[model samples]
Target: MTTLEDVLALVAIDSVSTNESALAKYVYEHLIVNSDLEVERIGDNVIARSVGLHSFRVLVAGHLDTVPGDVTASVIEGDVLHGLGACDMKGSLAGMIDLALDKTPRPVEVTWVFYAREEISRSQSGLLEIAELRPDLLVADVAVLAEPTGGRVEAGCQGTLRIKITLGGARAHTARPFTGRNAIHRLGDLLSFVALYQPREVQLEGVTYVEQLQAVSVEGGVAPNVVPDVASCVLNHRVAPDRTLDQAVQWLRDFLGELLDEQDVVEVKDWAPSASPELMNPHLTRLVEISGETPQAKVGWTDVATFREFGIPATNFGAGDPLRAHRSDEYVTTDEVNRFASVLGEWLRSTPNTSGTSI
Candidate 1:
C-alpha cells in the first residue's frame, strides 16, 4: 500500500489515549509479517529492531495514541489526509513502518518504536513503559522522535511544569463578602500577572527556545449565594532547557512571591523535564544537514525528553505542521509525508562522520 493509504488505514483505527489496543495489534501483526527484524510487544507498545551488529544504531519512534477525536469522519482531499492524528503522528508512523519494512542495507542498525499513551500524562507514557521494561531495546547512538515537525529538525523540547495554587479565605454570605476574604477575587491579580508574562528566550546549539506561562484552570466556589473559603488555580509553565524542574518551580515561586499571601499553598501537580538540543551530535547534525532547513527548538513537550532521560540524544523530525496538532482540522500532505520518508530513509542509509563536526 502507498504511504497515504497507510496513513488513512491507521487513522481509521481508533487509538485515542487509552484506547490503542486494536491499533497496537495491527502494528504488531504488520511488523511481524512484513519485516525480518526482531519484534516485541510490551503492553500496547510495539518495537522492531534490526540487530545488524553495526557500530552505530539509530532509533526511530512515534506515539500510537492521539487525543480523543472522531476517527470515522477522517477524509482525504486532493493530496492531503485530514483526520485527528493524521498530522500529530499517523503520517509519520506510516513512514516509519515503511522504513522498518525496507530490506535495503544501511550503514547503521535501526530500531522502530510505535508506542501508546503519549498524548496523556508523562507517567503513563508507553515510551517510559519500554524504558522501564526493556531499556535494551532503546539503546542507540542517536534517536529521532516522529513528532509532527513539518519535516524539519525541531531540536530539543520545552519542559512543562503544572502547579496548583490555593489561596486562603473565610466563608461569608455573598451580601457580606466584605466580612471575609474573597478567594476568587484573588485570581484576578495572579491571572493578570500571568497574562502580562514575557516569554524568555534561551539559545542552545543555535536554537532559541521560548518559555511560556499560562493559567489553565481555576476552581473555588461554594454556592451562588455564599463566599468561598478556598480558591485554586492551575498554572502551566513551559520551561527552557537551561532550567531543571526544581529550578523552574523555584522561579515560579519567586515570580509570584509578592502576589502570594503567607497562607497561600503551592503544590506541584505534574511536571516533565526538558531536553537540550543535541545538534552537536554528528548524527543529529547530519540530519539537520539533510533536511536542508535550519533547526528550530520544539516549543512544546514531546517524548524526545523521555529519550533524553535514557541518555539517547534525540530530536523531533516528522511530517505535518505541529501547529495543527490536536485540532479538529488537523491534516498531513502527501508531499510532507514523502519528504519525511525520503530524508529519514537517506539518513539511515548514509553514515555520519561521528567526528561531531558536521554541524
Candidate 2:
C-alpha cells in the first residue's frame, strides 16, 4: 500500500495516548511480514533495525500514539487525509513504515522506532521504556524524530516546564466577605500577569528559540455560599535551550515573585529539558542540504530532547504542518508525505560528509 493509504489505515485504528496496543500490534505485524529487518515489541513500543554492518547507524523514530480525538472520522479528499494524528504524526509514520519495508541497500544502517505515550507526560514515554529495557536497540550515531514539521528540518526542541502555584486564604461568611481573603479573587492578578506575558526569543546556531508562558489550568472553589480558603493554578512554560530546568524554574519564580505572597506555594509539577540545534552535525547538515529548506527551531517539545538525553544528536523532520497538530481539522497531503519519504530515503542511502563532525 502507498504511504497515504498507510496513514489512513493507521488513523482508522484507535491509538490514543496510553492506549496503543492495537496500533502497536499492527505496526509490529506489518514490519515482520513485509520487512527484512529484525523487529521487536516491548509493551506498546516497536523497534525494527537493520543488522547490516555499516560505518554509521541512523535511527528514525516516531510516536505511535496520538492525543485524544475521533479515530474513526478519518477522511480522504483528493490527496489530503484529514483526521486525528494525520498531522501530529501518523503521516510521518506512514513514511517511516514505507522506508522500513523498502529493500533498497543503503550505506548507513537504520533503526525504525514507533513508540507510545508521547502525547502525555515524559515519565511514561515509550522511548524511555526502550532506553531502560533495551538500551542497545536505540544506540545510533544520530536520530530523526518524525514530528510534524511539513517535511523540513525543525532543529532542536524547546524545554517544557509545568508549575502549580497555590495561594492560601481564610474562609469567611459569604455576606461578610471583607473579613477574609478570597484565594479565587487572588488568582486574577496572577492570570492577568500571565496574559500580559511577552515571549522571550533566544538564538542558537542561527535558529531562534522562543520561550512562552501561559496558565493551563486553574482550580479553586468550595460551595455556592461558602468562600474558598485555597486556590491553585497550573502554568506551562516553554523554555529555550539556553537555560536549564532549574534556571527556567527560577525565572518563573522571579516572574511571579511580586504576585506570590510569602504564604503562597510554588511547585514544579513536571519538566523536560530542551535540546540545542545540532545543525553543525554533519548528518543533520546533510539532511538540510538534501531537503534544500532552511532549518528552523522546533517551538514545541518533542522526543528529540529525549534522544538528546541519550547523547544522540537528533532533529525533527516529518510530513504535515506542526501548527495543525492536535486540532480537530488536522490533515496531511500526499505531496507532504511523499516529499518526506523522498528526502529521508535519499539521506539514508547517501553518506554524509564526516569531515568536521561536532555534536
lDDT digits (tens) for residues 74-165 of candidate 2: 99999999998999899999989989999988988999999999998788989999999999999999999999998899999999999999
The 10 consecutive residues of candidate 2 with the worst lDDT sum are 350-359
Q: What lDDT is obtained when candidate 2 is compared to the true structure? A: 0.91
Top candidate by TM-score? 1
Q: Which digits, one per residue and each the tens of the lDDT, describe model 1 over residues 75-142? A: 98989999989998999999998888889989899999999999987889898899899999998888
Model 1 ranges off by over 4 Å: 355-359
* Pairs of colliding residues, candidate 1: none
What are the TM-scores, per candidate, against the unseen true structure? 0.96, 0.95
Clashing pairs in 2: none
